[model samples]
Each structure stands twice: as structure tokens, then as C-alpha cells.
Target chain A: MKTKNGMILSRYYTIADFEKEEAFLREQQRKGFQLKKFVLPCFYVFEACDPEDMVYRLDFAEVKKENKDSYIQIFTDCGWEYLFDVNGWSYFRKLADEADEDNEIFSDMESKIDLLGRVTKRRLVPLAFIFLCCILPQLVLQFTGMSSEHSETATFSTFFFWFFAAMFLVYSALFIEMGVGLNRLKRKYSKG
Target chain B: MEEKLKRVYVPMTETGFYILFCLQEEMHGYNIVQRVKDMTDGEIVISPGTMYGTLSKMEKDGLISFIREEEKRKIYQSTPLGTEILQLEVKRIERLYRNSKGETAVGK
Candidate 1:
């Protein structure tokens, strides 16, 4: 971990990997760094601290700006410190102590599964819709030469198709990854 | 309608049971957590994620209804439907406890 100006910037794509993200943050805390804020598109800002074991958890919520304060107050009142919100997900941490139950921000399997379902609806569904409804049709049209073209628009059209194709590939990978992660969490919780 | 509701909610999850139990009186999300903690003597603690999710689902299912807001916090209480379901659950638990205690045989 490198620190300059009292903050360390680390990059991690944690969109669909909540458990991995929590483990990463916990490891950082164990190394004497605590996460301060999360910037969009994978930047985590950390502040130096004494090495301590901290448990980090993520929750997906659609809190409007007006309701944000009360929403956070609920968590804070329950002993979970509010760290930051990024992309509709809230990050929280608590000290890992002798009380085995304190480490979890979710107490029951049903609630854990519900949280994953919300995350799927909020983040993954939209990406999947775009990939299937928008990008796939355009790609098919381009490949089949069914899309009308003119000399003037040919270059721009070709560039646009390739750009969208690349984006579709990336979104497709993300959609599948997120779907799988949610399913795994659901299965794990449903078993118990 | 009541019979159907009971069928759906008879086997309440622990979290759902606690949330409905706490909302017997009007309270906000945070207050419900504290109340449950106090009632259970720290044996059960509902996390914010679980509390909020349960509250939302209960409200949507008509098991709970929102009262006037105290500032930005939404106050809620169990509806008649919620109370009926909770009572059924309590009776079910009571029977389980009584049977397990050998006061009555399992099939009797």
C-alpha cells in the first residue's frame, strides 16, 4: 500500500464481487489502512491507521438524495459506521470484536438473499436489457448488411458499430458475472 | 383473505417475526432494531439492511402501514393483518414449545 498526501488511491472493480470487495477492504484495514471513500469506476481512497481488524460490508439501496440522511442514520444508530456511497451501494464498517455476530451487517439468510436480489434489479437488469435489446439487434443488422448505408455516413456508421460491439461484449461479460454472483449468494443463503 | 394471509406468513422468518413484533406499536426503523435488541437481551440483533428490507416488504404486503413521519423518519405499525399473522405465529411457537417440553405427545 502506497500513501501520499495522507491518502492512498487503489483501483478495484468490485461491481459484482461484494464478498471479494469486503475481503479486500478487511485486508487493507489489517495492513493499517482504512477505506475513506469510493470514487466511481474503481477508485478506493484509504487513510492510514493502526493495524486493526475491521469488517466491511456492502448494501445495495436506492435511497433518494432527500432520504439519504435518515437512511444513514438508521445504520449509524445500529453501530455500523457509514463510510461512503457509490453507484447506489452503501459501504459500512465495524470493528471485529469478540462478539461473533457483530461482524455481519446482515443477520439472517433471507435478508442476505433479498439484498442480492435488489442489487440484481438495480444494476444487472439494465445492463442485460441494453445488451439484448439494443446492442444485439444493431450487431445483427451490421453483420447481415440489412442496415442501410450511404457513402457519407459509412465511416461514422462503421466506427459506431464497432464501438457498440465492444461495449456490448464488455456489458455481456459483466451481466453474466453479476448474475452468477447473485445466484451463488442466493443458493448459499437458501441452503441454510 | 385473512386465511390466505396467514397461510403465506405462518412460518415467519426470525427477522420478519421480530420486525412485526416490534411494530406492534408505532416506531421507526432504528427504534424497531433497538426495541428488538432490548426485548431479546442481545440474543438477536437486526442489521440495518435486514431491518429496512423487512420493513419495505411488510409495507408492500399490507402487513404494516405507515403512520405520520417524524421528521425524515417513517413511522410504522402493524396492521390488523400483521397482528393476526403474528398471533398465529406466536400460537404456533407456543405449541412447538409445549410439545417439545413433553407436556403433550408429538401426535397427541
Candidate 2:
């Protein structure tokens, strides 16, 4: 659950399906609690407000302090109320009008595809790389070191073994789940 | 006219095309969005994400250059390189238009 207002809700919005997160925020708006700010790793803070049809959208921009002002200004000029940006994800909302059924920040399929590419490039790829190069190597080392059979070294290796093993499984599941999700979304836009 | 840049942008996306087209006159990003919507009869609406991304990419690729900022909105204009690419794209579109004329174009 993302929100019901005043009470903070912690819901992890995976990078794979950001559209889902946007929908969730819109749903929250419909229910009368509007997102006030967001904290990393799944905390969405909301404030009680009159229920109104507000369209929420997310943009993946690694905006820096220098240009963030102008970046938000452009959206403001175009009529989007800039909520807050967390990490590289900028959240926005605007009153849903009569023809706002398909209201979007990016008007074309190619731009949508570009958004997907940015998410994959800036977030997913680097995370996947870390799991591949760093975690995978440690996993192998732990497995080999577990063979020492005695001393603090053996105990240390056993402890490290389980830790790496758990991390490996976590990384594997995340990689597969997000990888598939990204490919499916990309195909939907590319083929649609 | 680097072949690399042409390959990357010659067959410009609608978003790219309009951004370049609108920036032929120095204009704000949001203004360009509105202009494109008007020009296309509301067939397309450039979202802030797409607008920002295209403006940034075009500026980097030397297609659009920043002119100034007013009210915090960055103004942009097409560059010489951008104009060259746009002219090439116009020629391509002209060819497509002629083909769309179909059998009725036998006289022309």
C-alpha cells in the first residue's frame, strides 16, 4: 500500500514498472491523500487533501543541483506541479482534465522508449554489473575458502559463505525479475 | 555534417524533428511544446520528460544551442548543424509526400 494519508506508507516501487508506481500515486490522489514527499527504499509520505483527479507521472533524470531549478521550471511552465524528486526519479502531478485520459510527459513512443533506456542505463545496468563483478567473485572466493577445514579462517570463511550465498540469491532474483520486466515493457512500447 | 551525427539523428524522431523545427526561432522549451501541439492539431503532446531529454540531447549533439533563460525556462535555438540536418530531413519528407501523391501524380 502506497498511502492513505497522514500515515506514511512504505511500498517499494521497482525500477522495472515505474508506470505502476505512477498509477499508485494517482490512485492515492483519488482517495484524498496526496503524496507530499518520498523517502528512499519505499517510504511515501502523504498529506490529507481533497480527493481530486490528478495525473501523476515519473521522469528519470539524474538532475544536478545546478540545473534542477530550470528542469523543474520547464515542467511547471508546461502545467505539471513538481512534487519532489527522489534519487533520479522526479515525481509530478497535474489536475486531470477532460482529455487527460492519456496525459503523459513524453508524447511519443520513441520518447517512452528513451525513458526506458535511461532507467536501464543509469540504474539497472550498474546494479547488475556490481552483482556480476563484485558479488560473484566474493561468492567464488568464499566457496573455495570454506575448504580450509580449521582455525578462525575456516569459521570466517563459513560465515562469509552464507552471507555471499544469500546475497547471490538476492541479486540473482532481482536481476532476473527486473531484466524480464524491462524487456517486456520495452517490447510493448517498441511493438505497440 | 559528421556521418556519425547524421546516422544518429538524420531520420529524426518526431520529438526531435519538432524540437529542432520549433527552435529555429529561439523559444522556451514549454513554448515549443505548446507550438508543436498547435502545429500538429493536438495529435501530439510533448511531455516534460521528453522535452527536457530532447533539448539536452540536441544541445549536446550540436543541433540546438541554449540562447538564454527567462523565468527559469531555458531558451534554445537550432544551430547551423541542426539546420543542415533539418534541410536533409525536409528533402526526405518531400520525397515521401510526392510518393503519397500516388497515381494522381502522373502529370507532375
Candidate 3:
């Protein structure tokens, strides 16, 4: 099928390549072959042809608005195996064409996730600059004979001076080491 | 006198290099991915997402230009300045090879 932009839908199928096996399974189903009683420890597998290993199964149906051919499969597995299983399912519903525009959390999540991503993106350079901008100037004044040793002006400046000085002394070497290590890892993993 | 080669900023990636290299033949994104994988012994794989992203960035930077879209995928080729930079990079690598040859020969 071609869209408005003249783009054709390319269908690609993967997994369980033997068509004959699928046909046989379908034929067996059509013939009313019932094996429910014979199979004692059976599992209701929605996605797979025959049932395998699983716990309790629930039956529920919901409409998918994106694509008309899409459907969902929910699997209730035992233990913490649910963590490894994909949570949500999306499918195209039959009435998707006539459905109203629904609420979207994606755009909101996208912005929040984007901020988190950028915040953690590049830290070393800006952090170093912040330290340089705030702390470096005070240290300069202390060692340069520009220290205001008289009255309250000297005391207040000296207090801030030592605070930044202590912070710089403690954090500088550690930050530099971390920065170098990060750059090395970045270069090593860099595809160029 | 050595010509002062202008630097071109491509994405700093193996996929970026392969994409730029394949554009010497004016191929599309999927074709570039296949050709690059074939050339690199399937060691490097360029995801469709990365390919399109890099292509857009390169086009924005004027290092690549789109020729036409065929069968949905947009075909692209290197610009004249892009080709010039490729040649300069080739020369740089050749010079490095020559310098390494002397160093290797010294130990032998």
C-alpha cells in the first residue's frame, strides 16, 4: 500500500521460516483436534504456536490507535522474570482511523529525559570552568599581597577566600583525574 | 609550497568515514551501510538511525549533497570541497606511512 507521500509499505517477516509447519498447525486447529485434557502442565501462550513454560495468564483486549494491523500480547511470568519481559504492547486498532487525538506522555517524557541526558552529557569542562571562575580569583588575591587584612573588609574576604581555597585544594586533583579518565574512555570508545 | 588544506568537520566516527567514503560513488543510506559492512569485513555496522542523522549533519555542513531519492532512500554524494578534504586526508595518511617506514627500518 502506498501512502500520501508515495511511500510503499515494505513487509518483512522474521522467525519460524517453515510455512508448511504453520499450515499444519492451522489445519490441525480447523479439524477440532483437542489436546487440552491430555496436556496436564500446559501454558497458554498467546504469541507462540504451542504452549511452553509460564505461570498464570490473563485475557484482556484493548484498542491500538497507531496502526490498524497491530495487536498486543501480555505474558505473566513467575519470579522476577517479569523484569526481563517487555511491559507494554502497541497495535493498530480497527477504529484508529476514526479515533480522536488522545493525550500524549511521550513529548513530556521526551523533554524531561532530554534535560537529564544533556545534564549528564558533558560535565568535565563546565565544572572545571565553574571552579576556575568562582574559586581561582580569590586564591589570586590571597597570594598577591592584595589581601585586605584591616577591618571587616579583610575578615569577610579572608573567610570566603579560605572557603574556596579549601574547596579547590580538595576537589581539584580528584576532578582532574576523573576528567582525564573520562576523556580517555571517550576517545577509546569513539568510533573515529 | 604545501597547499593549506581546509578542515572539514564530519562526525567523528567510523560510520561517518565510511559514509563519506561511499559517497564517492553517490550511493543511498542503505547501500552505503551494505557497502561499508562489505568493505570492513562486516566489522562495522551502521544503524539506520545513525546513518540518517550523520547524513543530515553532513548535508547541513555542506560536506555532502543529495542527488535524488530513488526507491524511498535519498542518494547522496560528496561536494567538491568534501572531495578536496578527502584528498588532503589521504596525503596526510600517506605522509604518516612514510614516516613510520623510516622508524620501522631503524630497528631492523
Q: What is the TM-score of chain B alone in each candidate?
A: 0.90, 0.90, 0.78
The CA lDDT of each predicted structure is 0.81, 0.84, 0.45
**Candidate 3 chain A, run of 10 with poorest lDDT:** A73-82
Better of 1 and 3 by DockQ: 1
**Residue A179 Cα positional deviation in candidate 1, in Å, after optimal superposition:** 2.0
User: Which of the numbered candidates is closest to the native, going by highest lDDT?
Assistant: 2
A1-192 per-residue lDDT for model 2 (tens digits)? 543336588788678978899889899889988888887778888898899889999998767687798999988887889987777888888998677524778767787888888899998889988998998999889888888867777789989989989999998888888989989988998875
Q: What lDDT score is found at residue A119 in candidate 2?
A: 91
**Tens digits of lDDT, candidate 3, A23-48:** 33234334432112111132212222
Per-prediction DockQ: 0.69, 0.74, 0.02
- Give all TM-scores, in the order shown: 0.85, 0.92, 0.38
Which numbered prediction scores highest in DockQ against the true structure?
Answer: 2
Lowest lDDT sum, 10 consecutive residues, model 2 chain A, at A1-10
lDDT of 1 by residue, B1-108 (tens): 768777878899998998899889999998888888899998888888888778878888899998967766788999988998999999999989997887675457
Pairs clashing in candidate 2? A105-B47
State how far residue A50 of model 1 sits from its true place (Å). 2.1
Q: Is candidate 2 or candidate 3 better by DockQ?
A: 2
Residue-level lDDT of model 2, residues B1-108, one tens digit each, is 477898888788888888898888999888997898899998878888888888888888898898888888888899999998999988878878888877244666
Error of 3 at B44 (Å): 3.8
Ranking by TM-score: 2, 1, 3
- Which candidate would rank higher by lDDT, 1 or 3? 1
